[model samples]
Target: MHQAALLGGMIHDASHYGWKVAQPPHDWRKMAEAVQNHVKSLNWGHRVQLQDRKVKYFNFKASFVNPHMVCGVSKGGEETLLSADHIVIATGGRPRYPTHIEGALEYGITSDDIFWLKESPGKTLVVGASYVALECAGFLTGLGLDTTVMIRSVPLRAFDQQMASLVTEHMAVHGTRILRGCTPLRVERLSDGRLQVTWVDLASDKKDTGTFDTVLWAVGKP
Candidate 1:
């Protein structure tokens, strides 16, 4: 997704290198299909490597029955019990959603689903201050979409704060709108099929509303 965004800048730079080419239109569907297909190919490669290593693969939902025993349930509802000398749990975190906000889960998406979207999320509101949030906003802006970021506090909170400011400033100078010290209160679907986001300004305690084609939450992950 980020690479897709950089293609535009590269086109602009082409003139400096004597490649006088016109700025071409971006095809979201084509880029999305290519990315998805590449990801699927990588997954297939991993499966093949595992198979060649003589590893038994089970596509199942597993639950620990005891310290050494596990119960696995398949998609078709078949269950099996397996015992091993050792058990290793390796679950990864996923993007978190603010379920308390009205219509959040129903109307909004996250970093996980944005790239997978078949259609472009026209005008977007990205909520949160993490690097993930900024990266998404930057790419969307680079793709020539109307993108705004609603930040509750400092962006890149865990990283170097001074550098974070520079990163955000660069984005702002390049055309991304940054809404600081604000948090979303609710998300509602509008009559025209757009999303209406209501947010509050932390400093003024004032509420405001804006409509967008998509709302993305990048708050954090558990």
Candidate 2:
């Protein structure tokens, strides 16, 4: 659910029919608004819990909500029988940050967090060589910020060479500095809370240097 467009969001599986149902294209902002509205539509509804503090390593207890013991299966050695018309496990995959990079956890911002940003960053450094990384870099640069993309190898390494080169060129032409073949070493916060990025340029054999108000780690996603 990404790559949103101005009129309608990017369409996924639009050509597929029968086995593959097509979902109508939607505006990203409008989709977000709709989700918020749907959530608000529920009044007192089901039990909801808000945890202010981060989870401090706890095991979850399994309590069946359905009464009828139709679906008989004790996978985790559950003492109680579980039954329901249908079970839906919507626990989706979450993006993870690379542990090798220093200060990434501290200064790093992900796609989940970037949407809530009230003030656009003065400068943004995106770390990845993938499509998402490139798209984010372009978006930030279009918003009138000094955006830089640092990739361990050539930008868009996974795509066709010629097409990737074209996109890389276009990004640079649009004012998004592309730093390919650079591996981020650390992300240090200055006194002003800005990120001072350090890296190594594999191609040039020189110390890579970068600074930005925000550091977006777009290094691959699930």
* Tens-digit per-residue lDDT, 74-111, candidate 1: 99999999899999988778998999998899999999
Q: Which stretches of candidate 1 lie over 4 Å from their true place?
A: 15-20
Q: Name the regions of candidate 2 deviating beyond 4 angstroms.
A: 1-92
**Which one is best on lDDT?**
1
lDDT of 2 by residue, 1-222 (tens): 223422121233344433444555334355456545655666223323222343222123345555433233355754544555665555565556877889998789876666655555568888888888888887666555678888886767767989999998987986889877789889899998778988998877788667788888887766
At residue 192, give the lDDT of candidate 2. 81
lDDT minimum window of 10 residues, candidate 1? 4-13
TM accuracy, model 1: 0.94
lDDT for model 2: 0.68
What is the Cα-based TM-score of model 2?
A: 0.62
